[model samples]
Target: DAGITQSPRHKVTETGTPVTLRCHQTENHRYMYWYRQDPGHGLRLIHYSYGVKDTDKGEVSDGYSVSRSKTEDFLLTLESATSSQTSVYFCAIADRGNQPQHFGDGTRLSIL
Candidate 1:
């Protein structure tokens, strides 16, 4: 569990629709991250927040956005979602940069 929870556990959406995933934490950590996993692409970071309102884009962030309003919540949204965005999403929390990150099981999303 790692004190993390991802909403909707599974989702099936159509192409061009909008989708949002929620990640909630009980650890009160300082860093929260959003990532996606695909067959050959592996896991890639989409966005991350170091603290409230302090977020930065990642390599594959062209279609994703994230917001963190507090230490316990991090939200990831895909505006006008596409089939390429169909992947398993993950949320992770880290108490310190040098420490290993703790991750949520993941949210499986499919865009038809």
Candidate 2:
């Protein structure tokens, strides 16, 4: 599990509460990403980081934010949880943008 690890493998939160999910990697990859997987949407990118303090919004960044203060850690934060945001989140890392990414098992989040 040195490649990647996601904390709080599962979580449940009430609507309007703030939730933060962590993704840790030991591979020291250059590209780290946050994605949410849902029934009809498949996998949707939420945010990504190219380097420390460098991040960008993705297709579904509306209700989420990300931070990367180090090479090994990437965090995804749901400012205020909502039922519509309930889904499995996955963290991925790659040496380069074009390289295949390695993904963590996933963090299942449910908001009531």
Which candidate leads in lDDT? Answer: 2
lDDT of 1 by residue, 38-68 (tens): 9988889999999999999988999898888
- Global CA lDDT computed for model 2: 0.93
Model 2 per-residue lDDT tens digits across residues 55-103: 9999999989888989999999989999999999999999999989899
Best by TM-score: 2
- Cα-lDDT of candidate 1: 0.92
Supply every candidate's count of residue pairs whose N, Cα or C atoms clash at under 3 angstroms: 0, 0
lDDT of each: 0.92, 0.93
Residue 112 of model 2, lDDT score:
94
Candidate 2 lowest-lDDT run of ten:
1-10
On the 0 to 100 scale, the lDDT of residue 97 in model 2 is: 91
